[model samples]
Target chain A: MNYSNLFRIAIRALIRNKLRAFLTMLGIIIGVASVIAMLAIGEGSKQKMRGQISSMGTNMVMVMPNFQRRGGVSLGASSSMALKYTDVIALRNEAVDVGAVSPEIRASGQIIYSNKNTQTTIYGVSEEYLSIRKLEVLSGRVFNANETRSMAKVCILGQTVVENLFGKGADPVGLSIRIKNLPFLVIGVLKDKGESGMGQDQDDLILAPYTTVQRRLAAIDYINGIYASALSEEKSPAAIVEVEEILRRTHKLKESTENDFRVMSQSELLKTITSITDIMTYLLGAIAGISLLVGGIGIMNIMFVSVTERTREIGLRMSIGGRGKDIMKQFLAESIILSILGGVMGVVFGYLLARLAGSLMSSQAIVKTQSVVLAFIVCFVIGVFFGWYPARKAANLNPIDALRYE
Target chain B: MNTIIEIRNLRKDYHVGEVTVHALRGIDLKITEGEFVAIMGASGSGKSTMLNILGCLDKPTAGDYLLDGINVSSMEKDAIARLRNQKLGFVFQAYNLLARTTALENVELPLFYNPKVRARDRREAAIRALEAVGLTDRMHHMPNQLSGGQQQRVAIARSLVNDPVLILADEPTGNLDTRTSFEIMELFQNLNEKGRTIVYVTHEPDIAKFATRNVMFRDGKIYRESIVTERLNAKEILETLPVEVIEEFD
Candidate 1:
């Protein structure tokens, strides 16, 4: 028999019992919709995290001193003096992949301006800090290289620090603030940076020249850490390797000795976040796939009942001239049509569900084209798999016995 | 006349819980083209079994059966199905028309199984077959809307749509009234006069007189075979029957 005729006949048979056919498709519709919606939400959250991380800085790598041991007692990274100014200078000069390098010194003190005092951490960095960390001067200019070299007592105020010391919308440029009881002139005010993924208020700090902090406020000789930016994200790993090579040689650490410094790139943090999201996506997909399996079983159950109900009709067709293959094709076509129709409806509903979920969660839910195609293919395969046994049973019926059936 | 069906020593056995039931025992029959043959028997006489074997719905245990010179007993299931499509037409006692379908679509059913019939040709052929059964005006009516006799006529039209070499009717008028039975028989006679071969199975001796030949079965074997020396014309009999008159109150 021709395919078109067989298809027509199958459709007619399904239409004969409209309520039963729709009931059979309901499971599949719900199954495909949940699968699509879950995957979209998972993918959306992952993308949102990536966007948050990128806003902090692009391709920024942090070099910190490892834990130091004194008299068999472990001192944390901040107490260690393993990283020095010379190592930072060597990394900036020797590493080709490094775009900008800044040495950092950390201190926390009370900043007082016009009787409004606030306690905040102050970071002493070089002039390259603005470009490497992607910080913008909102109102005034940043400290020049000459000011950093001359050890000028100039500082930059973060948005939170400006608000805390001089009230909201205050520009602290050319204003004096005391840190560690020493007066410092505000050179610039940075743009607001909101909060980091770890719940740290990013706009709650201050910036000063490393030389000024090391020589005047903290009275320190060795630097605490170094920050460098790679030319691009792809070159981050290579830049880390170059930084490690330069730092180990500059510190005069032998090949057998373990290095006292560590180089970490933004890509490492990205890897951790992506892996977590990947697990979440798979977990959601697997749960949704179980419902699809149940839907397939529902199809199988309906097909079995249909075959039993139509035994007499099958016998009549066989007697008239239909082969076993034709009977099988007719039944299989009914199931496939049901699943494909359900799949189409499911995709539309799933898209709407994802959009609704995205708005409620304040995240962007993206429905990937690949997920839609794969879900359809999966539904088609399920139809064939579940439809096979019942169709085969229908085909194997004895016409004489079937015709005699009541 | 060309021989349309030939059987020699045909035998059928049914195993009912380890007991052998002989359905057909050594039956030899020959039916030629353009002949209207009636097979008469009781319920257990195995006439239905013979009809099933002739219809290619069942295979005989040991026999050589030929339909239109082809050895159907030795053919596989699919091959026999193909042969049935090309050679045989069947009308059941229950008038097995598909429910919820127009008479035209029910008649078009058989043509869909024939690969050689195009869609447009199938519709045209179905219409022609319905016209032959005098159902042209009711072609688009659903089976449920049609009378028992009209539904049987639709079944007949369906059987003839494929233009088979032989038409098989199993008590075609079993579910109809006397007037409707005579009307169907008249249609059969009209088709038979046009050179269409027919094989009919029934238990009514009165109904058997309409056929040109009669074969009687007793206990899985043919007991009597004879040509009807005097045939009954269904149209003439229908005219002689009293007709009910409805009174007009208006």
Candidate 2:
């Protein structure tokens, strides 16, 4: 018989027991739906991370003191204080790929403004720091080269710091705030930068000239870190290499000695984060695939039961000229129809579920076309793989024995 | 009359575990078109086995069997299946109509396996077969909705739908009441009179009397063979029986 006729017969048979058919399809539906939703959520979170990192400036690079071993005792990067203003000047002047460079020295202390006080970190940087870290001055100007050279007591307050010290939406430009009991003039209020991918608030700090923080507040000579930006995103790796070489040369490290500073680019961080999320996505997809395997088994179980139930009908068909292959094809068609229908429904259900979960989680859940296509191909293979044994059993049944079966 | 079935030394053996039981030891039979023959025997006397072999449902242990001039004894499973579809029809005692299917579809089933018949032609042939069995009015009813006699008639229509060279009926009336059995037999007789060949299998002597020829089996061998001198007409028998009153509940 033709395929159309076979499908018609298979459909009619399934319709005879609607509840059973639907129940069998339920397994496949749940399997495919979970796979789609899980993959979408994983992809969404990864994309969100990349977007946050890109906002931090795709070409941005950081040079921090490496963990130093002094007399077999390890001191972390924070306490090393190995970076210096000279290293920043060297990178700015010598590294062609480096677009901008800034030396950073931070001090955490209480700031008192008009009898209101809050604890926050004060980052000492130059005008280039704002551009490198994608910070913007909302009201006034940033600390320029003369201010950095003269150790001028001027600061730029982040939005959160501004709100905390000067009240919500308050313009604190030209205001004087006391930090570590020393008076500092606020030249500008930085625009809102929200939060980072690490869930840290980005707009909760104060910016000042590196010379002012080193001399006035902490009384330190060495800087904590150095931040720079590449001329373009594509030049970030080259910029990082240039910065590393300049720092190693300025530190006067021997040929066999490891550099005292570590250099990293924003794209590297993005890659690390996305790779982790990729693993999570596949792990989730594999877990969901177990359910699909179970669904395939469900199809096999139902097909076997159906074949047994219709033994006499098979015999009758055989007597009327149905070949073994015809009987096998009929049963296989029934299972394939069940699985493929479930797969289609699952794709729709998964897309909706992903959207719902995405909105609930306040993130975008992406449903890739490849995932849907893969689900369909998997469902088809599942249909055939699971439907084979039972169909063969039906085909191999002796016509006489089957007819005589009660 | 064309010879529709010819068998020589047909033997069928059944192996129950390591023990072998000879179901049909050695048998020779010939049936031609337009002849109504009944092969009758007691239970376990090999009548069923003989019918199975003749219908090509079972391959004999050693024998040559031909149906409509084609050697079917050594044919492969698929070839035999095609031959059965092309040249044979079957009516079982249980009616064997697919449950939940309309009588018309059940009748159309045999034609479904015939590649030569299109969907439209299949339906038309099924309708004609139902008309021949005088079940045209009940064609749309499911098998469960039809009475035993009507259900049997639908089965007869299914068997005739393919227009095969031979129709095999295994205890066609075994499940029916006497009146219904006679009605089905009358339908068979009517079809036979229209030049359709039939092979009927039953242990009932009265049922066997409806056929033109009777072959009896004892153990696994044919014990007796004879042409019916006084053939019993099912229509006359059915006419003499009391009418069944089907009560209608309002």
Candidate 3:
């Protein structure tokens, strides 16, 4: 038979039993929808992670002091911790495309101003620290090098500290606040930085001159870590190499020995975060695919039942000169049509579901076009692959026996 | 007269586990063009087996059966189907009208199988077939809407659609009342009188009396053969004969 005649017969047969045909297609619908929805969700999380990491200033490197502890008691690594004030100065002088490098000294203390009091972290660094960390001075300026040398009693307050200490809508510039029993003048109110991917608060700190923390808070000359920025996020590896060579030479570590400190660029941290998210997506999509396989099996079962039920009709057709291939082609075409229709509908619904989830998150839902296309193609393939056996059985039936069958 | 169908020492067998049942016992027969014949037999006498083999639906165990002088016993199934669609027409006891289809479409089916029949030509020929069967007014009605006799008329119309020279009717009118059976027989008699060759099977003596020649089978072989020179007309037999079929012709 020609294609149109076979198609006409298939359509008429399917329409004759609309409810059964719709039920048969439901499995394919669920399979396609889940595939699209799962992939979209996985892709969504990936983009979200990348965005969060990018929020942290890119191209920046974290240099922590390689502190050693013996017997659970702390002993400062003065020799191994080469990210010092001298190294910071050398970075500014020698390195090209090096934007800003600051030695960080942090101490936790309570600040008192009038009736308002709050306990927070106080980070002391050079004037370049604000620009490197992308922190803005909302109302005042960061302290200059003269302030660091003279050990000026100047500090910068984060948005949250300013709100708590001086009340809302009040500026704390040029005001004195006591930190760890040391009196300091507030030089600026830093800009508000949002939360990180690890859910740490970014706008709850205090900044002051590096020397002030050494003299008044820790009573030591050692630094905790160094925060260095590259000219651009894309220029991170070059900046990392420059920092490593300078720190290695400053520490004077011998050849064939592991470096005392771990230097992590922003890009490395971003990749680690992305890999974890991508794996989660894979796990979720795999679970969805298992259900899709179950759905394909469901189609097979329904097709077998259909063949058994239509046995007499099959015989009649065969007796009327319908060939085995004709019957097989008609049934297979019906199944493929049902699956493809279900897949198209599923893609539409899956995108809607993903969009709903994203709306609840106050973010845009991303529907990967490739995933939708793949879902449709897989549905068609599954229908043809699984539907062939039952159709073949219907075709191979003996006309004489089948006609006499009850 | 040219022999349209020639069967030479045809035999057919069936296997049930290890037992081989010989369904056709080396039967040789030749049917001339435009000859009306009746094949009669008791239950399990293998008449159905002969009919199936004659219709080219099943192959004989070892024989050469030729249709229109072409060897058909050994041809593959598709070729046999093509031959049947072109040369053979069937009328079974059940009428076998498609339940969901109209009388016209039912008649059109065999022509649809004939690749030589174009779509418009098929419709015209099917209309003519239905008119010849006296079912022109009921052409659009579904099979369920028609009586047993009318449905059988539709089946006859379907058989005539392809202009097949040989018409094979296996126990036609078996399920009908005596009056309806005679009416169907009259339709077949009229068709035969118009020079269409027909082969029919029957157990009733009254139905067999309608044929010009008779062949009786017992134990998978033809036991008796006769020519009824003064055959009873199926229409006259319906009017004069008793409502209950007489069994004396046995």
Report how far off residue A163 is in candidate 3 (Å): 6.6
What is the per-residue lDDT of model 1 for residues A289-348, given as tens digits with 9 covering 90 to 100? 899889889999999999998898898899899999999999999999888888888888
lDDT of 2 by residue, A268-355 (tens): 9988998999999999999999998999999999999999999999999999999999999999999999999999999999999999
TM-score of each: 0.89, 0.95, 0.82
Candidate 2 chain A minimal-lDDT segment of 10 residues = A75-84
By TM-score, rank the candidates, best first: 2, 1, 3
TM-score, B chain alone, candidates in order:
0.97, 0.96, 0.94
Candidate 3 lDDT, B27-140, residue by residue in tens: 878888878899989988888888888887678899899987889977887787777677788887888776667899778777655667666687799999999999899988
Better of 1 and 3 by lDDT: 1
Residue-wise C-alpha lDDT for candidate 1, range B1-250, written one tens digit per residue = 7899999999999999999999999999999999999999999999999999999999999989999999997798899888778789999998888888889998998898998899879899999999999989898888888888899999999889899999999999899988889999999999999999999999999899999999999999999999998899998998899985634221
Best by DockQ, which number?
2
In terms of lDDT, the poorest run of 10 residues in model 3 chain A is A75-84
**Model 3: residues with Cα > 4 Å off, grouped in runs:** A66-82, A109-122, A125-195, A199-220, A232-234, A361-363, B1-4, B32-38, B84-215, B225-250
lDDT to native, each model: 0.90, 0.90, 0.81
lDDT (Cα, 0-100) at B153 in candidate 3: 95
